[model samples]
Target chain A: MSRSDNAFNQYLDLVRDNAAVMAKGRPALLEAVNKAGASRLAEAIEAYKPASDEIPECRLDRLFAPDYGVNIARVPMTADVAASFRCGVPQLNSLLAVVANDIFRPTDVLMRNMPEGLTVCSLRQVPAEFEADAAALLADGADKNSIAGAISDALAHDGIYVRVAPRTEIEKAVQIVNIFNSPVPMLTPRRLLVHACEGSKVKILLCDHTQTPAVQHLNLQNVYIRVDAGAEVEFYDIEESSAATHRLFSFRAVQHSDSRLTVNTDFLSGGVTRNEFDISVPGDGAYTSLSGLAIVSDEQICSDSVVLRHLGSHCTSRQIFKNALFDKGRGAFGGRIVVDEAARFTDAAQTNRNILESPSARMEASPQLEIYCDEVKCSHGATTGQLDERALFYMQARGIPRDEAKRMLTQAFMVDVIDNISFEVLRQRLHILVEKRLSGASADCSTCATACHSQAPEE
Target chain B: MEDLLKVENLRAGIDGKEILRGINLTVRPGEVHAIMGPNGSGKSTLSGVLAGDPRFTVLGGSATLAGVDLLGLSPEDRSHEGLFLSFQYPVEIPGVTMVNFMRAAINAKRKYLGLEPMSAADFLKTMRQKRAVVELDNKLASRSVNEGFSGGEKKRNEIFQMAMLEPRVAILDETDSGLDIDALRIVAGGVNKLKTDQNATIVITHYQRLLDYIKPDFVHILYKGRIVHTGGPELALELEEKGYDWIKQEVDNEQI
Candidate 1:
């Protein structure tokens, strides 16, 4: 057999060898994992090709190899540990009240930072009131087709589940911190389930970070959200890992009637980052807005795949994704919107814009719309180009240096995404972080601890 | 008194095609010189070459502002050395607020001059004082630079920026191209208010409408990349009355 075949077999063998340890006493989940793994083992090598036409350049096997030995280490989450982490980043102290926080490791989940009005615990130990609903949601959305999906599904037996009370509004946002620090090659699997009951409102922030740049690893995450009738939910996910780490983040959310849902993803730094979003509006009068920004450089790659479905009448969805690439960086965006025959008066629009700062930098964008109804409004557009040289010269002629002019233009390109955010403090904090990233500041967790301290905004 | 701006045998072009050929000009402090010519006569090229636009290369020439070598410095450095160009078409920069853009420009110049940066209060006060010269609205000052601005508003903004920087040599390149009579009057009035014995101005135009508002000490007629005549402000009116056919005929015959 060839080298890649051998690696694939070795990966399968590792998954089989650690079945019991990774399963965490969930028999049904293990059965599902084994079934999915067996089906994949039976398919031809061509099965490893990219799953979508928009991702022709993708090599799925190389991008995702759980060959990192499956090693599970547990660390308790205490007040001191949480406080130290919070104190390291000064902006976080003033920006986030952190109503609920949880940290996930390679194969373990630790939940210690818990404020009032939030129920944070392992999926296996959910309270009796929310236990049945959480399990049903997970079983319905579980990945049952691909190798990585099967592996993550099995590891998700030890995932975190949160529930926001019905008819209530959360005063502060909930923070979910996922930290991956491993000495050996490992695959960290994280699963999060959030259920907002009827007439409830909540905002969530998820951050992915690596402790060091020494270890090579992959973070596979699955997020499932249910927004009930008349509810409003906002989810923001930010990824700032080291260059040695790869990330496959997925989010699937369903909305009921008269609900509003918004999801924003910011990919600042990573080795190879792919974010998948699937939002479904099944009830009439529901609205969804999805926005994302990615900055890639130095052989890094970041792609976002989004699918929005309108199934009920008068539902609306809007999506905008922007990417800035420099120094051989690569980026791709695939956005698709579907409106059913019964979903009359549906309004949907998708826009993807990119800037390539270097000759070697590349980007691909594909926006598609499928409408089976007569009275629906749908539009999509994609553009890829370099920065406006005229604008740069204009700024320089006004006494601004060329480098500063470029930075200002780049930052300006990303302001619309940040402007859509409803939180004032969060918007201000993101502006600073984006400026720092554009200036080539250190984005690793360790450097962030010290860099953010000195760069904090003065009162 | 020393010449504020001296251009000697300056030749430049874009993409290897020479535009400004054997051009010579001099402007003493407190003097306003107007360069008038028909279309494609290199009126704007001189302003671009002096402002150090990379597109138009300096084939063989020398330009000095305030006794400083202008050709050797970058565009920002030239601006810091007291040179400004009011573009015919002002660029629209989205997402960059006027406040931030002006602050960055002012601070960069200050750093080049070895002076401390301006305080927020001081900068705002300065902005307010200069904004009135052109009747710029308070809302426009907080928005992005020239984004979604009308033609008249953009012209007014250019003069406001000129007033803020207070350049020693200001080159207005067709600033009155898209302006109405009222806007032309306001912009020219602002330039006149900012004039001083320590600075000079160059007004490049195709018509004498702007010259009517801002009187010039001397008028130069540029033809075929060369200045064919130099006279007083009446020269603009004469060219307006006789048209460029007479001058073009005379220059073409001389070249033959």
Candidate 2:
């Protein structure tokens, strides 16, 4: 048998082994998964095109699920572990003090850690008020035919359902912490669904972290967000996994009239990460802003594929993504803005900028605009280059060392994205984290705990 | 009095094209020296070479600041050796606050001198004092370094930095290029206030208007990469009145 066929069969057999999960799933979800599975087989037989032609081909083979046993059982959160769960990072500890938390160890929810307005349970056990919305989101995602989407629906056993009450403003951010720790290679998947009711305001922080660095794992995640009229939501996604882990994320958001949505994705350190975004503004006077930053070195890879659709008049969308790659690191950004015929007076802008710290590092960026309306204003730009030598020399001339100058310039290059964050404390924390990452300091939260303890001068 | 800045037969060029050819000059402490010449006479090139700009190759030269070999040091080391060059065109470093930039510079120099970093309160106090000398706005001091600053504000910032560093030898390259009369008076006044018996200033300008405010003890007319004439402060008035035509003819005739 050919390699592609063998790979397909291996995936099929793995799914069959988890037949109980399929049996427990919704009928529509199961049918969609089955059809998605058939399409995947055909694609394997024919070598289908990647999801986005502008970006580097997605290596589906690398995404094949490992048959190893996953740690689905809840790891008992000891008092000591709970006390040190903030990873001993000063900024993280300080930021966590004000935010509510929902901690997930692998796919198991820590019930004691659940905050108000958040429900974490098995997919089949979602609350009655949110079950229909969650099912609809999954069913719509299955129709998208993305390999990760299909796999997420077929294998994800746990779900997080959040409902922001109407006219209620959440003062503190609600943090969803996904912790991955296993001695052996395994697959972990979960679904997150958020519904912000009318006139509600909320902020969410999603942190993906790994406990160990030597074990290989795959973190498959899906997020669905819906904002009602006049509602506002801000979501920050931070990924700091180990070199042996791969993170796949599929995110979708729908906005109603006069709603605002802001999403910030920061990839500080990871082995491989592929993020897909589909955000639609179907109501007038709605605004959407998506910003991302990726700081990677070694053989790390970061890719983002985004599609922002304007289906209503007087809607606006803005996107800015920046990447700084070193060593043999690679990055890709494929962003598209589609303005429908009815979406008159739309304002859309997209920008992707990258800096390659080494000659071997590579970046590919493509910004596209598809506007069918005449009254829309759309602009897209993409640029990839090295650090500014003149700026570096200027700093050095001012008595700042070359290394420090480069760090300052790099931080400057990324500050604009971080500055747009509505939360002041979180913005400051990210600034510190980005500086640490640029200075070659280990940014891994798991490692930082030990380092901080050993290096605490006052302690 | 000992010479704070001494250069002997300094020859430099860029991209294999020679600019400063066998130039010599010296400045003693407490003296303000004005180097005047027409455009393309390598005025900026001389300052660039002295400041160790990597773009200009020092073909053959020897420059010393406080008896330390200037050419052999990196730009930052050159700075540590008490040589400061206010760039002809100041660069804008976005997102780096002026306060942070000045603190880094001060701490770097302090480190080179084996001293501890200034405390936050002390640094801000010093910044406030130096900023007052230049009449710089508090808002500008807190913003990014020269980002979105006007030409006059940039020059004021340069002098403000000079006051902070208190270098042994300061080279002001075209500090009056874009300044109005009032701004020129303020900038030159700032330079005058910062001058001391332990330091020297080199005011490089095209016109002698700036020299009217800050008197120069000695003036040298540079032509075609060489100092063809040296005289007292009156030499600046002479060049300004004659518009460099007479001096150009004299130098060109001598070359023939």
Candidate 3:
């Protein structure tokens, strides 16, 4: 055998022989408990999750109802399982689906953005591949928890980003579908990093989900977006996990000056989806918008938001969070608009409005504003109540069904936030999807439209 | 006479407080009728009860449209049956765009009528023509339904919707409340343009302004919930000049 074969065999021998050594105590680092270079890394792995006392089981009917679709790819994507990644200095950035090379670069992301000495690794292969790469990284003297965290971050970015060419313009919106199928109540961590260059605009739909009839899935994802000057970024992350899971999904961005970041998070599912949006303007005149729409039902879910806006001078930040709940569903909002003591001329506004469709449904919103600057316009407000019964009656009297009227009102409630998505096609497709989801899934398949179905490009 | 709409001794209230004691009226095609009343005389309440605004409870009586039980139908259903209520206060649905709402409404009505759904091109064309009647701006039409609309614009939009629907009987409920002279004229103009000899309009107003523009052939003075007086266009003029005291005194004396 060649020298490379000898090295491969040696690695495999190491993995097979140290199997008992790799299997450690619950929630402990498998191979990094003995590493030397990184002391804080093993302690970080201690933060990993063990199963909670009891498992929370739910019915499949309440999960993927008959009307709701059963997309094959979406199942795993929405679960948003926290896979592993290896942390090393990235060397290559390409736009390929899968690469089997001896390179240290992430070859999937179209435009890779990394600081010096940042290595990107993820669980991108089969079981054997995972074991081999994990063992190799362990041999490289890297700590387990830090590597796990770094891998989570890199996987998050790779998972959410579209891997088209740098110059390839995606006119239609692309959805970042994540799924978690783990039976164990594991603490799945994710970090998404993006750097969109000039004029390359894309709208992302991040759909997170977990399996039905399972214990609670705790998912944690952090997103970092860097839009180069003049590159437009429109992001919409929909957290529709099964009500059996609890998700802590934070989508944060570091926006360069003059780059626009439009973000809309939809919390239509999950047992508890706590979303934190930390957006800061590192450049003068940067624009950031954090808008959201959430629909809750049954004894299901609640979403809390803590938004931090460090808008620089001449920067603008707009926050809108809308919620619609029925039955025992509840939604809570705590948003703060912060302007630095020296962030002069900052314009920021926050609004949290909720519509409760049932007497049992409840919502609480607290919108706050903190401005130390003199020449700034900052405001915050929140309102929570039931859908206007009069409106329902009017529509019903016009021959619309009561349920249909409720759906329409809810749809109308989310319109303001939905309209902010600048991409027309993506906006329409999403609108269609939301209407279907709200109205018990109608028969509108935007993908089946001529524009998408045609062999050639036809809009 | 073929009655297009019939209300028989309709008594209603909100939260058990009786507002509309008993309202009886009949409207047929090719005619315009106006209901004029003083403040809090249940003018808006009548429209609300007719349109099934859930805020009010129907104490008694019923309303029928084109020989169909109008009270049993939903608002969208009533609209499908050509019963349009140009609301006094239209709702502002933040994310639902004007075009989307209209399309949903139009498709719903069409589904009931057993007609094929209109294509996008046709819908846009029809929207354009009807919006012209109200002289609505394209930017406003493209925005969310009634979102950030001024009082006049919302009222005019009601008329524009009335035009788009081409209902059998359009109920203009206090649509003139917040409008200036020009907006009232434009709204009334849109109503008049949409009114064919086949359909009628029920203009609910407190002032003679919208009456002056729409020119209701018959005017009813509702006093303490009932139509105490019904006459020609001159009744609105008389009420405008003399106020509501004469009709109130007449009801009081007749009762006592």
Candidate 4:
């Protein structure tokens, strides 16, 4: 793109003609977009087209609005945050270059990657209030480089960055919803700069809901992750895009020697969603775990996961994925464990399991290991099969109706990843979701064979 | 009057090996009938078939419970009809808590009898009262079904379920197998408490040890798949004292 290209189009028009700026004048909105070169935000949002018809109303726009008090300037910062001033070769955003995404991405590379030429309409009711706090974020952002260009490099050469300010000591959670009504397929790249202080923890939940009709194209996303020392960070994504949707998310992360990072994704509703997590531990005693689960049903909701250990001794990484198929849904998982020569004494495990609930349902898992380091403990395995008929029989013989029996056993099969959630409320809520999906999709559930065979109406 | 359970010319086995060959026995309500046999005898097979355990194929004859065609029903159907099998080896169910399993079983029986579901309060209250009958630890009632339970504890839990079900026919298949005297008494006591004139019990034990506590008015020696001798409760003493050798000799002599 030429230096004088549409680069500065949205902002130049607004700023060059400053009078009407106040008319569109939502302070918080200005603050969120101001820290970043407004030109960069405008171009990214301009090209990102969301693919899906049937868009549902979302509350994210209101959530990020100035009335939501998205003050970037006044938010406090710490030594680590102050260190983020050098977040890049040149620190571009302060709590106050004000910007943008994955650790939510370091500055705003995700916005820059909206599928080329596809216009992703920003969710409406835009937030008008934002206190520029790039410096405040610099005060709390990672002392190390938080303006990660790795992801931007993948999709955009010059790339883009938006400096974001921390609202508080985000402990236990960070929930966000990205709604798309673009009606066209797009590729999105997100870079994350998460710097959790010692003994701190956080959970980030991203809900990607599409309200567009099925476009026969695939959407792509590249996400980068970073966690500081002694900090525990959790990343979760929920995809409710309906049948006829296909998307792939590229997850990459670098964790410090002692920090813990976990990335989990769930497919409650999706047409065809494929996710890959490639994580590395550079810190000694640092750990990275990649785990996910999906209910594979008709159309396509396939998940693929990959875990890698780059460096750091005593580092443990685990990857587990489960898929339960019903009503002709197809699923496949291919996993690899790559251990670098220097990353010795690392304990790693990878397991992929798939269950077929109907004769028409199908699934397969392929687990691989490419370990270059010897004397290092690393392994990978995979298992695939239909539900245990004997287990079903035993459960049925105990008076549990057949469908409820399948639900229980299928739930038990997926219980490993779920029980590890470490939160009671969320875990139980997940079970409820699982129950609803399995029961809603499988009419044969809870009923015996005679009923199921007779009930099949040749649909 | 018809006895509670009657098995005539019962011939059953697994994979073509005959275990119970033409064994005839009868059990009446209010009576504890103990079947004492050697290791390979058909003691467990009878209980298996009675409980509708699908493992064995009944090769011959018939088994009737309370004048109903007992062998024709499914295991769960038989159970709902008040037939209980305190398994020699109880199945371990993980993730399914005891309270939840019990609730399901209780509701299944209630629904079969055309009764409404039990309120949570009544279920819990009944659980509390029955907890004392089987002498179960209050904590265990909330744990997963029979998971990580001691051998004795598993048996007690079986009787505890037996108590909750209040079956008209309970086949205690080696209920006293792993228990110390105390647990044995507790299990037997639970069975005794759930006893009624409308119910009958078939206590299958390898030794006479369990028979002493849960007295049986009728004792039968099941050997080589047939009841060689039947008499009063004293038969159990005779077998325990003389062992199966004399009985085998008597059979051989009679056959010759």
Best by lDDT: 1
Q: Is candidate 1 or candidate 3 better by DockQ?
A: 1
lDDT string, candidate 2, B94-139, tens digits: 9899988888888988999999999999999999999999899999
Candidate 4 per-residue lDDT, tens place, A214-255, comes to: 543233444554565676777776565556445656666668
Task: Report the Cα lDDT for residue B35, model 1.
Answer: 98
Off by over 4 Å in 4: A1-168, A178-200, A208-221, A239-241, A297-301, A326-330, A353-363, A379-398, A441-459, B16-18, B252-256
Put down candidate 1 lDDT per residue, B42-113, tens digits, no spaces.
998999899888889888878999789999999999999999999999999999999999999999999999
Ten consecutive residues with minimal summed lDDT in candidate 1 chain A? A93-102
Candidate number achieving the greatest DockQ relative to the actual structure: 1
Clashing residue pairs in candidate 1 (N, C-alpha, C atoms within 3 angstroms): A68-A185
**What lDDT score goes with residue B165 in model 4?**
82
lDDT of 4 at A422: 60
Q: Each candidate's fnat, in order?
A: 0.81, 0.61, 0.57, 0.17
Every candidate's DockQ is 0.88, 0.71, 0.48, 0.19
Q: Candidate 2 falls in which docking quality class?
A: medium
The Cα error of candidate 1 at residue A269, in Å, is: 1.2
Q: What Cα-based lDDT does every candidate model obtain? A: 0.80, 0.78, 0.64, 0.61
Using Cα atoms with residue i matched to residue i, what is each candidate's TM-score against the true structure?
A: 0.91, 0.90, 0.69, 0.71
